[model samples]
Target: MTANSPLANPADPADRGHLLTEQANPRSAQLDRLSALELVDLFNQEDQLTLAAIAGARQGLAAAIDTATEALRQGGRLFYVGAGTSGRLGVLDAAECPPTFCTPPDLVQGIIAGGAGALVKSSEGLEDVAEDGAAAIADRNVQAHDVVVGITAGGTTPYVQGAIAAANRRGATTVFMACVPADQVPTEAAIDIRLLVGPELLAGSTRLKAGTATKMALNILSTGTMVQLGKVYGNRMVDVAVTNTKLRDRALRILCDLTDLDRQAASDLLDRSNQQVKLALIMHLGHLNAEAARDRLAQHQGKLRQALEARVSG
Candidate 1:
């Protein structure tokens, strides 16, 4: 880079090194010249690196899940912070948690560099203002019980780095999700999840491979935390909000699977329990009224299996 380059700060780790994401991919040197089928084949081969990267980071990912689970169990919140494609992906994952596990929207929140408006428009410059990220963490009232995940594919987003630092100062559990190696952009967050998907198919366009891997990791983090929080029973999401016709069908299917009941019976049971799949199942299996089942569920801390085991043991 020239001396006039905006990213020419000698003190910044980001400005000093060769960014893996921005490096030209030798495999895709003739990308533009390739036929449609050739490009597709090349892209597919490159995408295979995403899963391998995740697999290599399995131990770290599992640690993140466990940390998130403990925090949420203690009535803490999870926040996803980032910018550009990384920020948008974080918002997408956070937005899906509620309806999927019946979690409150506040339970899982997303904060983009430029707020909600940046989700659509390109607020790329906002990520350069590192203080904004620190202020965002403070604005959310993050505490020791909270978990803040900073997503930055290039691993050099000043906004994400600042947020992680602020979150650390607040004594909150912080996880850093980055696509670059630790040596490229080192972080001090309690958990570091490196999704090294190599160089993207389009060189620096991390929205392709890095974005996919980040999305998958966020999915595992949220879904796995929910499962540990008793939002799931077996493979079924018992805490799912039956707000739509499709969800209603899923609720019925869950009930039918857990109990030897017909569709009509499950539907009736669901209605009697106010469409609460967990409550309905408990009501039917324990031979208790809706209120009694509700109390039992609460007593067992929303664990369906534990409640059933208690009933059998009692």
Candidate 2:
């Protein structure tokens, strides 16, 4: 369906310009005759629009993060539901959360339209079936405390809408991230994030501007949410899970950077803390053992910065 189509409207004043999504780009024709360098420059120029779109939706994004953080703190999960490129981006973000923030695998999840196989292939047809989306949420056993985010560039994907509807019915906090304006969003979402990235360079192909904006919004949502939840200490990713050689090196670097400790000392602390980067930092910086660090962390509700400050004052 085209952007101007009547089915896309949801009676929201903040979304009037959304119906002109197809007309948002004036340089589409120029791309056909552009040289390689010109195309690269054009892409870079369009990329700037993505950041502007996110800035416009910062308040909504912050609200979504706050709601999601509270749910997560109460032992709830965060689910990303989408299709096509949006789905793949969600999967990518969810996959990184575990290693970057030390979250459990089940704590953050991605549910694409056609399941795991859809990640590597096109599942465009699956997006048309709202029932499939609802079924996916049900199968995941989504609970009331969970937060479900529906991502769609056009804001009218039946699959994502249906998933958000189901999640809402289950008492989950439903958030919608769309490149189009808010009016294009269905009634299923509790918080609507309208990231107006204008139009695509290739006519209706949202993978251009729309996809880039969606990725940026997701990055902010996930990363900012993690930071607010105390997974970070100051500006450092203290909760990083050092699972592999590269991450192990990064953990040691973080420890050394934060504590001014030598590499050997950081490595020793990490080993003692079972490769938990946050605990290691606390143990070294606060001059505490593993158990003491754990207690301090718990006392401050897992906030590394607060725990460290408390240690200093004590």
Candidate 3:
């Protein structure tokens, strides 16, 4: 599969020292000599670059969100592929989707080079084995409908690149995220998100600025996609899972805030909807029973706004 495909070409790891992320920041030349307070201040100043980098990649980020939302709407899954810190961040974002948006666990997944064990330990060495990444994609049975996001701070992790290549072969939509310029480290992904935060304060330690910027990007990508998927309603997470006391309290508050119900009434409404915040809101607003409200929501593809609008139009 790799012989003719342009996306399968391996990046030349030779002389990667010239990459912008590998360069030392002139401003941080005396980092070790700084006082404790000075070090804190310097880190704070450098961290601001992460925000700027995110802003710079606004278009790419928006494109990714749109692609992922549409794919998911069509019953496709979203996968984040990376290694080391990047991998852990992907897993973290994927894990939060279920509790935050009430999504199925498989709807969003994270694949690291060394699997679950790598999340806690340093499996950085596995990042160099390109085949492992490709095998991971095949293991997931990635298809044309899925969206695979490859993350590598320096733009040259063989593991991430391999996963992207394999995803492309399986006709999946591919997103490549890195902190270097395309000229420095090119990729054949459908969308390229470059978080150009320059070099880290500790020279090649990308876990500093690059990691911060990557985390910010991932947060935006996941949250924006969920919002577009109708998991959010007017800035509220309507699909939030009510699994514990805190979430039940939050669900009650949401009911009260969105409707005329008081805390006690909201709790009753929540019980009527089986603790589903979206269904409870629909049941109250649409003046329908729990089953009817659930059917309406399903007919509208789980969009509370659409379901309610249908009730009004009907």
Best by TM-score: 3
- The lDDT values for all models are 0.89, 0.84, 0.91
| Tens-digit per-residue lDDT, 260-296, candidate 3 | 9899999988988888899999989999898888899
- Candidate 2 clash total? 0
Residue pair clashes in candidate 2: none
TM-scores of the candidates in the order shown:
0.94, 0.92, 0.95
Worst 10 contiguous positions by lDDT, candidate 2: 1-10
Stretches of candidate 1 off by over 4 Å are 1-17
The residue-by-residue lDDT of candidate 1 on 186-284, one tens digit each, is: 778899999998887787898998998998998889899999889999999998899999999999999999999999999999999998898999999
Candidate 1 vs 3: which has more lDDT: 3
Residue pairs clashing in model 1 are none
Q: In what order do the candidates fall by TM-score, top score first?
A: 3, 1, 2
TM-score of 3: 0.95
**TM-score for candidate 1:** 0.94
